[model samples]
Target: MKVLMVSWEYPPVVVGGLGRHVHHLATELVEAGHEVVVLSRRPTGTDASTHPTITHISEGVLVVAVAEDPAHFVFGEDMLAWTLAMGHAMVRAGVALGKPGLGDGWQPDVVHAHDWLVAHPAIALAEYFDVPLVSTLHATEAGRHSGWISGTINRQVHSVEWWLANESDSIITCSVSMEDEVTELYGPQLPPITVIRNGIDVTTWNYRQRAPRSGPPRLLFVGRLEYEKGVQDIIAALPRIRRSHPGTTLAVAGEGTQFEWLQQEARTNRVLRSVTFLGNLDHTELLSWLHAADAIVLPSRYEPFGIIALEAAAAGTPLVTSTAGGLGEAVVDGVTGMSFLPGDVEGLTSAVREVLDDPAAAQRRAEAARERLTADFDWHRVAVDTAQVYLSAKRRVRHPLARPDIPQRPLPGR
Candidate 1:
């Protein structure tokens, strides 16, 4: 199968789990004897004049990273404008790749879109090529805002998500909770939605042996420092955790808009000295911390699927996560790892205490969680399931009544 994937984030431009998800899935697809082409963007601040579009082969997959058009659009200041500009560039590259003698004359049997960020280009390219459009709605704007789309940007983003969900021939979600959320937000007339849990490369994230520690018991939190991520709740629970296990320290990894706010929260809760902000760490640094920490806590209020939980599990690190959205499924409460309700500071403290109190039990749970990876969360299985979805989408598009009629215009710069 010839698959074309459109995503705003890919390797060297990874902002979150979505990029890593795409990278692993695309590589696995290539290994499965399928031709995969990824249409992505160059990193910000990259000179477009010198490298307008970079085409390279990585792990048997062809990646075409296009440079953003020279438009005065700032992503943080105006995300919608920046996204549209990115879509324009992607469409130009896709058109060029399809033209005979101009490029490789490559055409995809299916166009897979990662999220709403690349919805416009994905839709345009799918329609332009007269192929099936498969989209994976990783998370919804309403879900992120806890069912409130108040601001203009929030509403705009929600609308775009709805449009993408409706436009797709088949939709894939990472968790059952996310599937329900997507259905509640944009349903009844939406395409077929499949729940495919996010996967990890377990071999690369092998369990690490820890040495005896002497200092404070270390607790690690690895993820975006966002309100929805519920980092504040961890800081709130720190005082209680310290009372039970004295000299317990919380190390926060990853950066976001809530950095300063979380720090202030720690100070307000009188645990400022115990909380350490380690900022963002690369994969190697992250794994080092994961292996070194006493336990990894994921206190998310709204998670599509806790990929971090899988990472921690892969590293055989004891996990104490909240049962929020897909996290409920990701971490089987008390079985795979300790879990609690979202935003429950007391519960968070209790769960952490359980891990610190019974180190042997925690290790047993971590081993069980790691064992579950091969059965449920392997990248090879994910690629196979995704390929099935693509086949289903192809069948849907081949139906005479289901065929989409999209008007095409002259290519840009023609």
Candidate 2:
């Protein structure tokens, strides 16, 4: 089988878990005797004139990274415009790939789109190739906003997601919670949605010998410092955690719009001294911290699926996470890792203290979590399940010209 994947982010341009997910899935699929081609955007600083489309083969997968169109739009300032411009560039690149003597005359049996970020080009290319369209909704805009499409941009994003869901021959969600969220938001008439959980490469993230600890018990939080990520809740619970385990320190890794806000929050709670904000660590640095930490905490209020929990597990670190969305499925409470209710500062404190107090029990849980990774969270299994979805999509029939009837509401001023 030949698969064409469209994503806004790929290796060396990773914005989040979506890039890693696509990379692993594509490589695993190639290993399984399938031809995979990924159409993605080039690194931000690369000049388009010199490198309009950079093609390379990595791990048996053909990657065509196209430079963004020369437009004066900023992603943060105007997301819709930036996305459209990106889609335009991707569409041009994809079209050129199908032409004679171009892109080695490569054509895909199925087109798989990662998210709404690449929806326009994916949809256009699938129709252009006259093949099945498969889409994976990594996260939804309405889901991020807790079901409220209040702002104009929020509604616009929601509309695009709805269109993608409806246009797809098959829809894939990383978690059961995400499947439910997509179904509810896109309505009942949408195509069949599959729950294919995200996976991790355990080999790359093995247990390492911990360096001798000296001062304080380290609690690591490795994720974006966003409001929904519940990083502030950890800062809120830090004082209480310190009361039990004196000198318990929390190290936050990753950057987001909430960085300054979270720092202010720690200061407000008077646990500023106990928290260290390590903004955006590389993969190697992340693994080092994962091995060195006493326990990894994930307190997300709206996680579609906690991929970081799997990474922590693979690193053999004890986990104290929230039962938010697919996190409940990822980390089995008492079996794999200790889990608590989302936004529960008391529960977060208790879980962390449990890991700090009884190191042996935490080690037992960490081992169990690692064992679970092979049976459930392996990348090979994910690729097999995803291929099945692609086959199902190919067998199904849908009108290419059909448009989704997404309802629109007038803006407040209008």
Candidate 3:
């Protein structure tokens, strides 16, 4: 199938799991004898493109970019507002979605939008070309904040999410938990939502598994340091964790608004020096650092299925987390790692200490994690599953408006 995939991030411009996911999905789709084209924002660490967004092939994936105007951005921000100007810019740029007006034989069979950032473009193109529109809803405000969205921004996010789901031929989410949330909040009429849990490219991530180790047993946290992420809880847990396992060090990664609060928590606990906040390390650096850790911590207060845990698993890194939302589905508890009550500091600390203090058990869990990752979470399998969802959407599109239950294939990438 000829598929046009739209996303806000690609390659070096990634803000979250979504960008990396789009890249690998596109690449593997091409590998499986499918024609895939991607439209994404310009990423950092690349030569500025002469075109609005440059087109290139990375490991067989065909990609194009359209640089949104950065001038409209707020003062002092380095990155473009992904969703703020993306919709209008994407519509204007998608004149090239299919065969240029020159009448090239190529045209897309499916219009796939990765998230809210690209939903507007997907809707516009599908409308213009009369093609199937498939949208993937990565996260919703309610799901992101444990059902605590309010005011104008909250309502806007909620409305846009509803509109995207309602308008699309079909909807895809990263987890079953999200699908339930969508249906419960938006009603069953909000298009059939299929679950395709996000996947990690295991080959790149496996570097951490095979990497050489150096120092004391370590604890790692890699993600936005924010209130929703439960970073403060992790900090509070650190005092107990250190008391039980003093030599263990914590590596906190990624950047966000709660950074100061997180730092203060670490300071108040008098473990600031032991906690290393390395804001957003690149892939190689991150993998190398992952090797240095005993287990990866994703103590998110409301994680809608974590891709970081998938990577950590692929890296043979054990996990310590709160059983918040879809995250519980990601790990098999005692098999892949251990979990605790979402907000219990003692439980969080105990879960971390379980692996760090017990070398034999942690090693057993780590090996089991790697096996689970390769078996269930491979991107190739995820791409094939996603392709099936696209085919189902295309079938629905061909029928225009059909019965809501058309025996759709199971949601992919779970």
Candidate 4:
């Protein structure tokens, strides 16, 4: 299958899990014998001479980076405009490919979009080419703010999400909870939705077995330092954790808008010195930390799918995550990893303590999580399943009267 994937984030321009997910997904699809083309923003400041760099990644995959000028627009002044410009650039790239003898004269069989950032171009190209449109929504704006669409920017984002959900021929979400969110928000306008859990390359994380640790037991948080991520909850729980395990330390990886606030929170709670704010680490450094840490913590208050938790499991590190959004479904509470209520400081403190207090049990659980990862969450399996979704979407588009093989939730008030 020839697939055109439109995403705002991709390698070298990655900001979060979305970029990593798309890169890996596209690569795995290539491995599965499918032709994949990824359309993403070109790295900023690329020499204008190389406006569109089409990178040939392996025989089956290609990445096209379309450049845009940042000087023309303000960052915070107009993010919606920035998003639309990126989308327009992707459309332009697709149109350029429609010309014959351009890079083997290939065209996409289906248009797949990740999130609302590329919705405009994905929808337009799918319609222009008369191909199926499949959109995978990572999370909803309403869910991120806990069901509130505050600020004009957020409202605009939510509106875009609604438009994308309605326009696509088929939809995919990372978790069942996210599927419910899309159904609730988009109502009858939503097309068939598929729930495909996020996966990890287990071998990449299992590079080295964790060695015995001495001194302070390291607790790691690997995500954006945002309010929705619940990094503050972990900072709040540190005081309680220190009362029992005084040698414990928390490592905050990944940079975000709330970095300064997290520093303030740690200082205010008197655990500033115990917390190591490692701004952002590359893939190698991140895996090293994952392998060395005693436990991995994801205290997200609104995660659609906890890819970090799966990474920790793949790394054979014990996980403790909150029962927020898809996280509740991702981790098997008490069996695979510990779970705490979202925003419950006390609950988080206890969950972390449980993992720390029982080393053997924690290791057992981590091993079990790894087993699950191998059995169910391999990227190879994810690619095949995703291919099935693409075929279903394509079939439905070709036959309007046909029903989807994957049962879709009925639209509200049906």
Candidate 5:
């Protein structure tokens, strides 16, 4: 099967897990003997001299980039114009795929889009080509802000998400928890959603299991420095954790809005000197740290799926995470990893200390985590499952007017 994936974030311009998810999914699909093409916004500071650029990266995979423009953005207004402009670029790329000698027989049997950022173009292309549309909602606008739809921009985003949910033939989410959220948000008007959890390639880490060491342990946290991410909670818990294991050190990797605030909080706790802020380490650096760290922590207040937890398991590092949203579904408490209540400083401290206090038991749990990763979260298995969804969507016959829920739009050749 041939597939066209539309995403606002891709390599060299990733904002979060969505970009990595798209990259791996497309790569695995190609390995499964399918032709895949990606349409995305050009990376920041890319050469904008070219109008429409299509670059063939590898066998069975190609990427199309449209120039990015942010001059119309305001401080606090809705970004509908920028979103639509990116959507228009995707529309142009979709049109190219339908033409001969343009994208080298790149026509797609299924048009799959990730999140609401690229929904407009995904819907337009599917309608124009009369093909099946598949949408994967990585996370919703309301979910990100903890169900607060306060401003006009927030409502606009939710409205776009609703339209996309209704228009698509098939919807995919990372976990059962996310599936429920999508259903509740769309209120019984949505198509049948398939719960296809995100996956990790364990081989990429190239790590081997190691026995717990007899020294000061390192606790590692990798994520954006934001309130919802709960990085500050980790900072607050560190002092309590240190009292038990005085030599324990915390290494934080990632950059975000709350970087300075987190630093201040560390100082307030008087554990500033023990905390090391490694801002946004690259893949090699991150993996090296993962291999050395005694435990990995993810304290997200709202996580659709915890990919980092899977990575920790693959690295044979004991995991500690807050059981919030899909995270509870991802990590089995007291089985694969330890869990704590979201934003609970004491619980977070105890969870980390569990691994620190008893190294042998933590090692046993980490081994169990690796076994679970092999059984459940391999990329090959996920790719095959995703292919099934594509096939099901492709087999369905679609017509422009067949779905009256979608808003009317001009056809490609009209």
Candidate 6:
């Protein structure tokens, strides 16, 4: 099926798990024999130009990136300001395609949007082309940060999230936990929501198992080290964990607004020297650290779905995460990995200690994790599942009289 996919993040341009998730999802969709076009706003390069909504660009699948420059409008605290430009660019691409041979009067079977970032365009294009609109929300800010953060201007962000959930023909979320969040926040206005767990690419992470880093057992935190990620909790656990593990090292491998505070937290905990602030790393560095770690920790206070945990599992590294949102969903509680209560530094310390004190246990968990990830979280499976969501959305759009017609699909440039 011809699918128009929209997201704020993509590979190479990706900032966090969302980008990686979208890229893998699209890649797997291609593998599943579907045509996919991705519309994302990115830093402008020289080759930027007007184009058709791009067709089968991947092997047996088509992916296109409609780029836009958002750096100028994004200065302070506008980390995701690119989403606005991305929405505008996607709308422009759709309108341009409708003009002549570009669209060829042939509409895509459906328009699929990744998050609220592309909601405006998804709603617009679906209406313009008279097709179905499907949106997959990764998380709500309420669930992600555990509070109401959409104040004032960025309240527009939350409004858009609500708009998309209301506007789409159907909606999908990464976990059951997130489905509840949407229902709670958007009420009856939200579209029919389904639980589709996020997935990872196992091939890149699969390698000849190597011995983990010795002396200092490496613990990794690989996402944006923001407050919502509970990075400070990792630092707090370090003080006690270090007393027991001695040479245990925590590598903070992402860049965000939380860097300096984390650096300060390290000093406050007196585990500064024990922790290595690896700053921002490229994919190679992240993969190398993933391979080297005795355990990868994502002590998030809130996470919609923990793709990082799956990546760690795919890399044959034992995962330790808080029993929050999808972090708990990915872990099988001592089978694949272990979990601690949210914000429980003591519990966090204990979980980390289990893996650190018993290297053999950690190794066993990593192997089991690899097996579980390969069996359940493969990108190929994810692609097919997401394709099913697309099909489901289309079917629902076709039978609007059976279900109350959701007003989201045909709004113009909304």
In candidate 2 the C-alpha lDDT for residue 20 amounts to 96
RMSD of 4: 5.4
| Model 5, TM vs. native | 0.90
Worst ten in a row by lDDT for model 2: 405-414
Give lDDT tens digits, candidate 3, residues 315-352. Answer: 77778878987788888788878898787888898888
lDDT of 5 at 192: 72
The sequence of per-residue lDDT tens digits that candidate 4 reaches over residues 75-182 is: 457788777776777787887777787756677889999998888999888987788999999998778777776566777787788877877888999999999989
lDDT by residue for model 2 over 2-77, one digit each (tens)?
8999999989789889999999999999999999999998876555786577888988988989887865677889
Write out the backbone clash pairs for model 6: 56-62, 57-62, 57-63, 127-410, 167-408
Candidate 2 runs further than 4 Å off: 209-214, 395-414
Candidate 6 residue lDDT tens string, 19-62: 87888877777777777777665444312454322344544434
The lowest-lDDT stretch of 10 consecutive residues in candidate 3 is 405-414
Pairs with steric clashes in candidate 1:
none
lDDT, model 6? 0.74
TM of each candidate vs. truth: 0.94, 0.94, 0.88, 0.92, 0.90, 0.87
Number of clashes in every candidate structure? 0, 0, 2, 0, 0, 5
Superposed Cα deviation of residue 376, candidate 3 (Å): 1.1
Candidates sorted on lDDT, descending: 1, 2, 4, 5, 3, 6
Point out the worst 10-residue segment of candidate 5 by lDDT: 405-414
Decide which is better by lDDT, 1 or 2: 1
Candidate 1 per-residue lDDT, tens place, 300-325, comes to: 98999989999999998998999999
Winner by lDDT between candidate 4 and candidate 2 = 2
Off by over 4 Å in 5: 45-47, 50-52, 69-79, 211-215, 394-414
For every candidate, C-alpha RMSD to the true structure in Å: 6.4, 3.1, 6.1, 5.4, 6.2, 5.9
